[model samples]
Target chain A: MNLQVSRFQFFSIVLNFIIYSSILMAPGITVINAKQDGWLSMLLALGVGLAANFLYLMLFKKHGYPSLFELMDRSAGKWIGTALNIVIVFYALHLTAMVVRNLSNFMITDVSPYSSPYIYQILILLVVAYTSYHGVKNLFLISELFTPFISLFVIGSLIVIIKHFKIIELKPFFYNPPSAILEGAYSTLGFPFIEIMLAGAFLTYVKRKDKLVSIALSAIAIGGAVLVITVILVIGNDSAYIVARESYPTYSVMRDVSLTTTFKRVEIIIGIAWIIGLFFKISTCFCVAMMGIKHLSKSKTFRGYIVPCAILVWAMSNGLHKTFIDFTNFVSMDWTLYWFTLYSFVIITMLIGLARKRA
Target chain B: MQDWKTTMKANKTTREKIVLAIVWGFSLYYIIGYLAGIDPFPITVWLKAIYGPIYHTLFGG
Candidate 1:
């Protein structure tokens, strides 16, 4: 069955994908490294992300919107492409596992300190596997339908927190040394930003190819703005020290917001937004990995793989880190570098394909 | 050289079998590790050991 997503849906998918896990953890990570300058680090990351997106766009244009698997096939030949797809599939699965683990870890540690991570893990996996089994159209549809609510929740949090914002807390901006700021920018650039390469998985499904670049840029810009706002508010309201110390600064800031004299603890809105966004994120990664697997194996049935995929993710995520600190240290010290290196090879191969085409 | 598209379309290729085997093997290791309460991320440990210094050198914690 052929699947197609309208440009609007494509835009929403990009927005949702980038915002997925970043809102909860990225601000804390950045604050620890860059302090008050974390927002500026995000700004730097945005510029780098846009350029990288432009490169992917050009590569897509040259290759005529092949899915990442098919693009590798065309550019690198059958055997090599299949091999590359194996690696890409592994990377995608690992990412999905991390997203799952991160969400479960956050819920267990921050929101419900009494609950077991396994419960959230099973709950999230079921939902992710369910959505992924339906195919790509449903994934985009869900994102299109849910992104507005996520946006509204984030906007509401910002509005409610505005009165609590202290300009003094945002002071000493750019106070971090150059290395610290660059390090923050480097990690941010590596993540939610460069991970936009995952968009290639759905590139073929986008109906209006002419508008692809614009849709991508707008999505990246909007997603970057969301991250910037998240960092600024976290720092502006709670200060960099609190943001650095806390595991989920964005959630903290949102939870701290009071709607009025009577209404407090408005974090449910943010929680809903996060859960919906994470659903889309994990589902997208799951779907894309399965798609790549299907393409590589030339299998006709994708549904058959969904449960196995979920089981694999569950095991890998469970085994990959024994504790939240292990998870954080791995993502901090290894994941960024590993993903950047992996995708950099992909971009290089694509660029080589482009060069060969020109030659 | 086998024509990949033809091989994949006609039947499960050898490469597919190899990939499946490898994936299943890795999955089994993880599953058994979980059951045995063993660490499943030696790769993570190894990479962190190797990359941690390089990362700190390049970016400085």
Candidate 2:
């Protein structure tokens, strides 16, 4: 087990983790709450998200036992550390379920309406399981390979659609109060921003830890910038009232892009890119969850849990929400605060553990 | 080794094989039940019950 990934690969990991499911939905999620000034909310989340990234980095001690799970044990003693690990494991698994559901919902609602979501779920799950079977580095390598395609397709679509951005869509910018805008940021702050910390659980395997901070924070910056631009472009091109109503607004906005008489259907490219992103995301979460179980059980190999975890993720995805609307309701309203609360719990425990070490 | 669990392996222990079987059984119970159109309990029931009061209160019923 001499596994180690380069900072470049780690950057790809964080980059994929940051933008995954957020690329399409972030605009709609923000606009729904903050109305026309939704990009502002995204900017606000980016600022907080970067600061949270800094705080997460600070939690990684420079000395021995730099791993977060190890740090928990060193700080809080055995039981609390184990408990914290369990919390992360559950969060990772649940988040995997959520991502699986997200992709399935997108395919069902936006792509093909007649198919059962489980069909999509099982298809992705099998690949995710195979990725897990190959290990975390495989996920990282694939992220590195696929990231450019996702970014290129996404940004290219944005560039093509930029000419359509009528500043009129952003008129009456401050119509939503600060509280409403803040609510928009709050909904997404946990989703696209905080979930990057999941990479921290496994990044200790990076051989050269120097510049980890720069790599991760820059991923946050780039990911958030892409998201903010998407918000502006989509809302700028389409009405907030209308974009806010759609499940995947950016995709729909991209759907209307026409390079010429023969060159439309940009949404399909974005759709495929999204699948790649979701694949990386689901694989990463599955790996993280497997790590949590491995750490807790002191198992000889976490790869052994891959199949079990994949099946559970598939099961959980199918079982979590009865309808796509329910999933959206959870995401827009509860997703942020839920992750927000969980991060608070983990942060407080870490702080207490750090203080205990000082004493 | 920190990497042992995360690095892919080519072989599995007997215990892991057994665990896999058990997991397959557990999953089949739900997957088959769902295909048969039997969903006794969904995760949303518990999730809604827990966060129900909060988000429901804010967003309305």
Candidate 3:
């Protein structure tokens, strides 16, 4: 199968992957942890996230196509390699389930309280399954087309609400305890950022392997800036207390914007951009999981596994949490450590492979 | 019965066939269960069933 994607398409995929669900929810977690210094926390997290990306790039340079799975195989023999592959596949599926659940919860809580969560759950899973069946080329084709509109609407919303931004909301910047900033950084690093580990699964398919590092770095930097600006805007407009209290601070801040006396409730723009971004996000995560399954099982075709995988993701999404609070608490408290542990495993495996190459 | 069993064995590797059967079988079972409005087995059951004792022994969670 021709899975090759261009530099621009790959960039769009990575950018959409980072911003999709994070824009809606990350600011709240940042504010809750770092208070007025939430932007700084994101900055710190971005630096750490970039360093992780550098590690991925190093692995890619050494072991080109097939990415992390190949690196694991080279680092360890067949038995251990297959075992690690299973673990990586599980992690990808878990992350995909979390994303699916996050979007489902957003719709239930903010968009439609009366609707059954299963409706959105099945609908999204069907869409994701269909996209994954067609493979990465078609997936990122939609990403490349929709990415512009998502970016335009996001930037437009920021401009519309530009006047409401207040300096006072960020006054006590350094006042947060060191632990708060560190926790916030850790959480941000785990989410939306280090989660680019999913993108590593696709790096092999990039037609211009030479541009991989630059493109990935640029995407991360752009995504980080958008996140920082989002934090600033959310805290600036609504105050850190309001941003922290709200379930979706970025969306809530957009809700408060009014372009003119006659115009109101412009948060709808934010919703439109976010929903579009999430389509690509969910698709990317599902694709990564599909890739993992193919590699682990040595399957010639991924299509056969798509339906079963989507069903498993849907089941996990539904069964995982009873309420949104539990979900967010998991994200803030445990998710970072869980995510970093998996990432560190991959990096360690790669480092071992690199050392052996030299030896 | 002997002919059918011979044919099945000739068509695929045992591992491939087993994986296929598991995938399709579990998928169909889950679909039927979902349509019938059967709640999924509680997530915590497995988490606790498996991880609970591990955590208790390792970190005493």
On lDDT, who's better, 1 or 3? 1
Task: Write one digit per residue (lDDT tens) for candidate 1, span A1-359.
Answer: 38889999989988988876688888887877888888888888889888988887877888778788888887787888778888888888988998999888888877889998889989999988888778789888888888888899878877777888887887787777988887778777767887778778898888878978888889989888988888888789998888888888888888877777788888777877888888888888888898988887777656656776788899888888778888887776666678777777888878877777777
lDDT of 3 by residue, A245-335 (tens): 9998888788777888888888888887887787788888788877776776676667878988888888778656667887786776666
lDDT of 3: 0.80
Which lDDT values do the candidates have, in the order given? 0.82, 0.80, 0.80
Residue A185 lDDT, candidate 2, scale 0-100:
90
Model 3: which docking level applies? incorrect
Share of reference contacts found in each model: 0.40, 0.29, 0.21
For candidate 2, the lDDT comes to 0.80
User: What is candidate 1's TM-score for chain B alone?
Assistant: 0.57
| Alpha carbon lDDT at A253, candidate 2 | 91
**Which residue pairs in model 1 clash with each other?**
none
The fnat score for candidate 2 comes to 0.29
Per-residue lDDT of B1-61 in model 3, one digit per residue for the tens?
A: 9999897558656666666676667656665665566745554444445544543453223
Worst 10 residues of 1 chain A by lDDT: A299-308
